[model samples]
Target chain A: MQMTKIKHHLTDALLMGYAAGTLPEAFNLVVATHISMCDTCRAALAEFEAVGGEVMLDAEPVDMAEDALADAMARIMNAPQTSLPKAKPAGGVFPAPLRDYVNGDLDRVKWRKIGGGVSQMVLKTEGGASVRLLRIPAGTAVPDHGHRGTELTLVLQGAFVDETDRFGAGDIEVANEDLNHTPVAEQGADCICLAATDAPLRFNALLPRIAQRFIGI
Target chain B: MLNEMHTLAKADAVTVMPVYKRTGNAGIRATGANRVMAEATTKRMAWVTQVAAVRDAKDKAAFAELFAYFAPRVKSFLMKSGASPDLAEECAQEVMVTLWNKAHLFDPAKASVSTWIFTIARNRRIDLLRKQKRPEPEDLPWGPEAEPEQADAMGLQQETEQLGQALAALPAEQRKLIERAYFGELSHSEIAAETGLPLGTIKSRIRLALERLRHTMK
Candidate 1:
């Protein structure tokens, strides 16, 4: 975790709009995808929705139309049964640039060990940049590492907690090189995170040097 | 009636007519459109119904029951989202009508019916907001209020109470963070600015708040 490498714009946009109910459908879909994999973002969005729900209570009540339900029932009782269209494979794993960050071959990439029970895979982005996926065993504390570039991490499963927050499945943590911190995975589940990085990680310990040489951290 | 029946036959020969017909072009249009839209809506509704069908009539009934339960809730939702009472009522009516017309679209795999319906309400609210030429006051409903004790409103009141209780169970810190972010219309940074807290703290607080809320709701 890097203290200065916080790239929270996507998270910010998602949290804000989700709270406001103003997020676009496409964006909401992406956000949903991210939240499903990342626990931190899910929690954040949930908080936003709850808050919105509360504010709604304070809103002045509106009178419902006389026949709204009857109309709806009439429509439902009369609605014809139909089938869903077939699922189509889009050009990318996801619909946008984010897709490229994921769906890459995980096995072929070089794996670098950064700490005990932690390994990383560095992948090249379309922008000719490199990103890393950091995997830690359950209850392992990742070595304190500072970021050197923009870092976007999406949690595929499990969860980890830092001094400031806890991230779970589908939660994305965006950070820059300036952010410095260490994250410890929760007991009983491995923390697997998909991280897109533009620069090398700055490891804080001598043990990392030995691990980096073989694992490429 | 003859003209509507003619249109219905041309669209989908299998379409069902309303049990009773009202008067005038409005009634004619409603009946005609309902018949046609029901046919059109079923194509999507089937996706949802397929999932519901497997669970049992109890499940199906629960799904079907959503119309009576949520139509007014959605109407009230529209009203709070800045629609007039009348427009909210209209939108609510349309939403339920849509729910009925597209009941088959309910896919339990993709989302719960509540979330799906909420998504529909959300989209409709956005469309309505976009169409407004001049912005009105923050809290006023756009249309005339219907009677509060109306059956629909009463139903909404009950559901809302349940939702409210769920919300209230969240920790005060988490709940307040959610409130400022959603109701207060403050950005994370803005919240940081107003509260004079660090931006990270605000974001973290919001994140924890949401997690707690989800746990409570579940």
Candidate 2:
């Protein structure tokens, strides 16, 4: 069926973390990007947000800084006209939130070849975790590896089949140390993914491991 | 007149019970129910109408209404999630300012005002939290369970209400984990540490709680 349905949607607890403001920025980006594309996750996030609202309403009301309203109004009046940063003009197939990070349309991403027919563009973000976009050629496979830490891979386009399952556009595969599989792109198209990892991967092959030291993959 | 008063008193009594059970405070729940219902309906409309006034017309009155509604609530939320009062208030102001500027991005088809505001407020809070310490890498909190697939769009409102009801019905232990994460702003590892439970237990308990919520809402 060529990846007709998403088999792996984000869980409620993760959505709760995203809604409640606990997830790290990298995870938050993954969740936000997924929510933009997945209707089910979007609806789920809204419910969590509604619950967040209810909880806020139920909290012990703190008396404001006496001039809070006045100051806020003053700031709003003098506020520099800031719009949400425009989505990248090269935002092809990229959702708005992800595009905010990608910063330009598809052509703008300066991909550097890492090795083995796979290239990557590491996104600069403020955190200990790392986020990057990977471009794997058609019919190629990511070096099979386990994670030293959690890894979240969200498909931006095309599809990849691994030992676990197939992930198409908008689907994310959450992998930790216990899971290891090579994600092989289907024959027809290249697979592009936004992947975030907090630690170096445990690559199975000797060559990728040596290259990892230099290439920082 | 006597009969009418009696009927209102009865109506108030009937309305209070479910909410009182949910909130554990009857006096507030009874009062809150009417106000919340009224606001919820207004917010649904505001996503379509009132928000546009702030965006297109620069309508101060419309902006004032949203500010009055969301600002303090956002502050309270940050406070509950571990921000100091001053920080929470400052972040709240930032959230409001961002709201003023980003009003153009408000898409009613995508999300309602509170949900969008919730995203902004929490983003500010999370950014503040991250500045304090980076989290250790860890697994996600369990997984997505099999379900009735996506709830139809028409069912979203009902699903949210049902979700609330289901949350209220959860066993205290499970609900406490949710509260710790949501209100306490603890990550899975931090939550595991604070509660002295194994990380796996925390994830599984939460996963079970969510599965129950999903099934109940479905």
Candidate 3:
């Protein structure tokens, strides 16, 4: 594992939404990928899940159908027993959740060049938000843009520096409508990020803004 | 060898819940409330044993006991979360069946039985109602495997009980907000709108558990 310190993390509200299973699939993908690498967020997620559990426990117990147990038992007997196969260690940058979307590791990603030596592969996810893998060449800067809603960018490999701070592997940058900054990949390695945006980005450059529609970014 | 023996002793201690007879009298809480609290905690602990039984022995009676207790609660949760009664019923059954199948995945040192069941039901709701795939975190192959100490499991269960009591003691409005959040009634923005949920202390214990699991994985 490349040992770059993770500075940014998932927000409490986002973690709670994930625990409640209410986040958009795109956001969930980003959160899950981050938690896979960051144990701090993993533990935080467990705490939110514990809160969900208590809420469920406090719910008034409604009566189920009289034959519910018997029916469930029958189903259990008929259903094929499923043992969750332990996930194989991902030797690549993408974690299990992102790997599932990419169909494999980083090498499997089918990249599409948008512009400026920057390439991306959009993963299909339901809901209003969109997630994609962005690969920026060494020392390259992604076009300056501001989010309309929320955008989550998780560093999978290498590091990126924006006006706010440096985000390295396992770090997640949560950008809302307030921030407009250009993220530049560090000089050593090409930065690979799994980013999810709830709304379209308003690019500062007119050319990229025009290209955004063609690229569906 | 000593560590193995210690683990065995702790496992034995956790299984003590099965020996206690179910009071089955939900209405008895009006009189001896303290005793009811103890019984509820014991009943919660018993679920750990029942899950283990279903996992190791495929014990039908144990599965039935778990179904009887949790199925109604799961259905009620789903119904409150906006699933129709019939859909809740169907999903509740599926959730129970999933419980039986995935019993081995339940780690008492990490989560209480209710927590485990809540996650299953929540995932099912997302898949069925929202029709969205839930991307789960990758599993650690070794699991909670430093041969989880029985003390850790007991402490976690106790903390979970305390958490439940704390939640129950919250002001009605605050409690209702929390319930709504977990029931999927609140959007992310709405959840952010609310503030000051009193989730204290238990977070450290869960974090410790995760650390232990991570350690064992290595």
Q: Can you write out model 1's per-residue Cα lDDT over A1-217, one digit (the tens) per residue? A: 1011222335554466655655333333334445533445544553344334434443445545554444544555566755564343343222222333344333333566665868876544233234456778899988888877555566655788886688775556767656887888888867876665545677788877566677544
Best by TM-score: 3
Report fnat for all candidates as fractions from 0 to 1: 0.21, 0.31, 0.75
**CA error at residue B192 for candidate 1, angstroms:** 6.8
Pairs clashing within candidate 2? A90-A105, A91-A105
Chain A TM value for model 3: 0.95
The C-alpha lDDT values of all candidates are 0.49, 0.64, 0.82
Interface RMSD of 1: 10.2
Q: What lDDT tens digits, residue by residue, belong to model 1 across residues B147-175?
A: 12222222222233334445566667755
Q: After superposition, how far is residue B34 of candidate 1 from its true place, in Å?
A: 45
Docking quality (DockQ) for each candidate: 0.13, 0.20, 0.51
Pick by DockQ: 2 or 3, better one:
3
* TM-score of every candidate relative to the true structure: 0.39, 0.67, 0.88
Give the alpha carbon lDDT tens digit for every residue of A1-217 in model 3.
3334567888888999999999999999999999888877887787788888888877888888877777777787788756666657647777888889999998888999999999999999998899999999989999999999889999998899999999999999999889999999999999999999988998999989999999888
Best by DockQ: 3
Please give, for residues A64-125, the per-residue lDDT of candidate 2 as tens digits: 67566667667877766645542323325776666667765567788999998899998776
**Candidate 3 deviant stretches above 4 angstroms:** A1-4, A82-87, B1-40, B144-147, B193-195, B216-218
* Candidate 1 chain B lDDT trough over 10 residues, lowest sum: B133-142
